[model samples]
Target: MADCVCVVSEFRAGNFRRVSFEVASEGRRVADALGLPLYGIAVGSGVSDKAEELGFYGVDKVFVADDAALEHYVAETYVPVMAEIIQGLNPAAILLPASVDGKDLSARLAARLQAGLAQDCTEVVCENGVLKAKRPIFAGKCLAWCEWSQGALPMISCRPNVMDCKAADASRKAAVEKVDAAVPEARSRALSVDLDTSGKVELTEAEIIVSGGRGMKGPENFTILEELARELGAAVGASRAAVDAGWRPHSDQVGQTGKVVNPNLYIAVGISGAIQHLAGMGSSKFIVAVNKDPEAPIFSKADFGVVEDLFNFVPVFTEEVRVLKSTC
Candidate 1:
């Protein structure tokens, strides 16, 4: 019989990702509801020392898989070791972040274990000792609640910034157990990686975001948005139109076909708010839209709206933010 709830914690650059704590907190809730223990799985090179951090978020035990071969995330190498650890625990439900790597890991693990999997979940709830996940469907037009079949293990990937991460209890500690990384020879391996050195927070994890669309006229105009974003300590994003026009890289695109974000504040400058764009960021806590056209669909969904040319308004907004930050 299945017993504990397991959360797969993700780390990068020797630090735990914020979503790791979010999922651990959610896993704690599920574990408590089911009257079971909460376990965390951490796999990476020299990561055993960091496994204890998950305890602050509520994990009762952590399984660490440390190996030089596991430094970089290769689906083939990670899936097998993770599967081995998970099978030993026989967890009732498994939680992972919906990050690029996490999503890949969860999908492969689900297939390997033949478990029921839910992806990009915005909410997870416990009902009658079972876990149900709420996720967007039909281009974010609706939400669907998903549950695993009677005998299948429930594996869920949660969207970042949507779930609340509680304050850590410094006194809490989890029992850490080391497991052999014993990875299989990969069919293919990454020879090298080009890391993002932009020094900006990732869009999916940013608390605030400033996004531009075709109305910005060209890529050069993004400097105005960048200035404001810097003052706000936010990330810069672009609509699909801007990306398609080559004004920004595809990494900055936010839409149904792009990355979904759930930031606390989303500022849309000159964006007309296509359904695809709304599908990605409509779950934001607060939305502010600035567009020259009053009839832009973005205004309908924005908590605050401004009708003005982005060229004229953005500069003034940037200056105001600068002044506010300077005074603070």
Candidate 2:
């Protein structure tokens, strides 16, 4: 009896995250293939006004949960509303961004709905009316293909940057419906939140990344990399060695044991390119590695390699990038 494909939209500062558009674009493809309408579900206090924007990316209709209790992201509050909407619409598949909150929300929703859940999916397709997902497993060592039966509702969390976001069509519009979500008293409430004021783009969503490793000498030297990143409008990343040495936070670490990033351009400064590190960003569209050691393994994978002392090269590189940006 399923008739639609649904997307769970994630928003911050009243703006939809990049993954929202990405998932909606993917959801559009699936809906078209199955001959069903694509719907978007937005949950947050005073978020009804923003739900219609999903239409720009391809959603035909949108469901909104606008309640004070839903102002902040609480799994306890979000799961119930999402479950109610899914049960009402009987969507064949639900797509979510594989963010920290999205991962948590999708898992709990799958359990509550007794549906099959697919996590970290890179690709999604509909074959003969069944939802099939392609996901990376074993820390990107291999990919596994999975399918859901027509009788089962499937919840899928898509990895960031894996799916392309379609350009917004300003002329498109979506019909919105306000859902009455029964939210119970929360056992815990978020009293406050701390914001990252660094102004750097989020690593998972960034199209360009500039990273440093142990060769930068120490934590203080990361300033040069930050300058370069700012000039390039890219995110700053770090290798495990830099993190272990207390030079960078674990949140900035990128590798097999950390976060996986597939940006359009990846610049590795002083990183020796261990197998674990390569496993994380090897899929980058273009790689530029700078290291004084000529035999460093990173060069083998880099589209452009430079052998020079980072201390000497990075400052000059940052200045040149700044100049280039000003000229443009």
Candidate 3:
């Protein structure tokens, strides 16, 4: 068995997400379980100070690979460095986020290292010296548990927003190691990263999500849902119908092909909640649905149900929430 676990950290516009912190905590937990030292790999042009935070999260060593060529994400640039580090240190496992960029890098690294990879994992743990990971498959219709057959370092890509950020000590220290890194210039590179501009909160991080569907009638009528979302400080999501109709962007679609979001509260207005759609948000903590159809599939999962037309109902709901937030 290898004696270390490495977590790959990403820097976007010089800031890290909670996903990185969560991965560090998870790596620490796995390390402790298997009697291995936890290590962190932070890649960027000059991210030395950020490496210090990894120490607070229980990392025994922080590997910093800084190169002027590493300034942007070129798969060719990062995968080689990650592969080199894993081969040199021979860590038992490595963890990265299942975010857009993360899947790309993790999959590439796994193949280059000829290692086993469990993608979009909800859980990973070492049991009796076996590294086991759990992930939903078949669009959440089934679950799979993975353990490497040959004991290759298990490369894992955990879904963002699924793991909670562990508390930090903020006083711990890590041995920092720097290696010679080269950026292999790619023939093709990112033309642009165009994120759909949104006045609504980011769906992945939002505590509340308000989603609408065909029942909302048309694109112009989405204002009702938008107003309700604004009042609740919730993100606006859409069913496949709304997205397909061009009423909302595909990024705002929450389903098997879209984003999987587990929020504190999910409010579905006029959504039918297909199994595929439910798979995405089924893990949410609480649900409230408003549909004129009492027998709608969405109602089966709702903690509260209102059988009424959302157009006639939202004004009252918005007023109540506004008053409640004001009082608090």
Candidate 4:
């Protein structure tokens, strides 16, 4: 059996997450550089039918483990199955998305396989047939490169939105092999899960994000930001200050203590850009800051800055965006 690059597909809520494609694309890059085949592992209920979609992103084959017990991500069951498949294939390297479930599964799988694991990597590459990864360190203050020991398998989890997702070819199709799920009895089971049904775009996966801070004044003021977010088809985020002030839910907080987001465009409204907050969104491709204070730290990081009161600027901007979108 020849060595190959394997990517674990991330499936949730009956849909494959975008990070799955990004991971696959990164896997393809490494695989090509190493002169190896790119394979994918899809573990989910009824995921077999959708496994072929990975081929569009450059996967040569897909190993599907579809079963009712695998519907929801249970680490106990998933870790064992993933480990078994990986051991059988004995791939040179394994890649997965650094998502909530992906992170959990990757960490457990690495421990089970005794492999060197790099989590939340922003960059990965193949150097001299060895897998090299770069990940953030010190609260996103710096990046560190990682490499596996000669005898250890290289395991990596790429951060969402950091990797480039190539244009998929709809005509491409991967060979699919059905594998037994062979789920074991779980030690614990979730009693219930509360999902956010607010219909807002998921912050981590969004292409554009509009975030607010203490400048919004209160919870009711988020309405203006929400309107702009809707107009821009972006997710709404809040700084730790806003969340701590009870102006926004913890789920919407974006900072070192909250969620890290890397979107194509990030609009910071009324945010002062504390280091903690910048740690979360500093990786954004482009940043636009709007603050009344000329010396707000957010302006220092923003590609564009507007020294104006958000309360006076936001409503007008929202209306302008609405009009521009209407014309389109």
Candidate 5:
């Protein structure tokens, strides 16, 4: 039985997602520790070009499943193909991103293989020839360590932004394997994918984020936050309150009830930090809170705070950012 570490390479718009690279790098480390090779699997239509890119991140070999039916992410189609790959490879461990698609695929595959699964892991460690995973529990207030039983295959889904993304090296080389896997007839098919055309960085992948809340008054006022975000080349986010009030879309909401975000810089504009909101973004490297209330809960967790009306402060802040960008 092969004991190599396997990573599933996820792609978006024909390019590798940042999390895919992160998992590849992390999987390399695990493979090295186990004295085994690192393998990558890419699934999609016309994914050969992208599959080759995994070599730059330290993959020794790649298995490419390029088929028209695999173009879009439908669990019904993906799970069966992936199951076949795992059964043949029988890897010691499998790593995937904890994204929406990743979660669905990993869970189904685990059930199929009867493997041990560790979800949303922040750290993966090796001890005495076994894999141990560190994951956040109770809304990130505590960490839990988990390990698979002896000789059991471990399936892990890592949270985004938890590990540092390693730089790609063009000098690295890998052997590409064209795998002709079986695709079963599916009851459902994804005819098309309507992408987010906001022209801004995706929230989970953005290094910098600018967010608004109920204090922004209405949806029209969110334009100022958008302007500031554009100046910083950052993503725009909204608090759950703003989303619940119909001032913003659910996709833009950041909180325990919504999408969790970890960024280098998070600027909260007029947001009163609720526990739920902090649970999502409390892991950011730096936090800046702007609100009129001096005793706002958000200020307690912020590295910097400003007690001023957002209407008066946001315009000036956006102008200063514009001036700063012009100079740089």
Candidate 6:
């Protein structure tokens, strides 16, 4: 008699992240609609003390599988843990965040349990007593709804920031269960572990992103871009050319193969619009592109296009925004 929605937790760079909150809030919604409980499961090293925080997000239960071996994200190590829990719980549904680590974990978990998984899902709805997952396909050009035939629990992964969560009473409490590894069961294992110890912003989670491209001339010009980003409460991003030139870290790239983003404001400086770049950020609400080339492809997608040199423009633009922000 398990009617619950389970969300896998993400713990990295020393703390819980936005994706966990996004998943918890999302799972809670689906669970509430079906009159089911919401369960939040976290796996990692030194992560047990944070279990209480999950309760604040409306989880009826928080499952923590903290282990030194699980310190880094390894699909092989994590999938079995999730599989054991899901099989035992037999919940109505399970929801995972549609993130890089989350995608890897969800895919393997569903495959092991002989269950189906939906990824990059933008919308989910219930129809004819079955839950429907709406996901984009063909490079996000088209969308489709999917339904599965078997498995007691339907599995889904939600795109970040796609759905706003409904506020819940954090005072509510849930069970905190400490589980064993179900060792030798996980099909995968970690080899080399490398965390991004470098203090740089990840594109998906950054609310403000300032991106640049070929128009910046060369690597040195990127410093101006970084400075502007720093002044504006934003993360520095780059187009493929900028990364290929070794001007910026690949982690800062926003594109299909890199990271897809929908930040509140995306500043594209000197990036001549390429379909690849647009594909990643066209959904951004406010796109401001600054390129001297009047016909640069970036302008077609920008809410405001500035036909001026980035070197000549970014400093002044940064100052204006700074002044405006300070006034308000």
Using all chains and alpha carbons, the TM-scores for the candidates as numbered come to 0.97, 0.93, 0.92, 0.96, 0.95, 0.90
Candidate 4 residues 19-102, lDDT tens each? 999999999998899899998999988898899999999999999898878888999989999888877887888999998788
**Candidate achieving the largest lDDT:** 1
Best by TM-score: 1
lDDT of 1 by residue, 71-178 (tens): 888999999999999989989899999998999999999999888899999999888877789999888899999987788789999999988897999789889999
lDDT of 6 by residue, 1-328 (tens): 5567787778874577777777787777778787788888888888787776777677888888888778778777777777887777767888888888888888888789776788878788876557889987776667889887855457888877665654645676557889885644345666566867656666777777899888888888888887888777687888998889888778878787677887788999988878787767777769999999999888888999999988889988878878888899
Off by over 4 Å in 3: 173-175, 191-200
Cand. 4 Cα-lDDT: 0.91
Spell out the clash pairs found in candidate 2: none
Q: Candidate 6 vs. truth: CA RMSD?
A: 2.5
Relative to the true structure, candidate 6 reaches a TM of 0.90
Whole-model Cα lDDT of every candidate shown, in order: 0.92, 0.89, 0.84, 0.91, 0.88, 0.79
Model 5 lDDT, full chain set:
0.88
TM-score of 1: 0.97
After TM-score superposition, the amount by which residue 300's alpha carbon in candidate 5 deviates from its true location, in angstroms, is 2.6
Ranking by TM-score: 1, 4, 5, 2, 3, 6
lDDT of 1 at 308: 93
What is candidate 1's local distance difference test score? 0.92
Between the candidate structures 1 and 5, which one is better when assessed by TM-score?
Answer: 1
Candidate achieving higher lDDT, 2 or 6: 2
Q: For model 5, how does the per-residue alpha-carbon lDDT over 1-328 read when each residue is reduced to its tens digit? A: 6657899988767887899999998898889888889999888888887687898888999888889888888888888888887677768899999887898888998898888999988899987667899988777778899988877889999888877677988788667998899877889998789998867699998899999999999999999999888888999999999999999999989988888888999999989999899988888889999999999999999999999999999889989988888898
Residue-pair clashes, model 6: 2
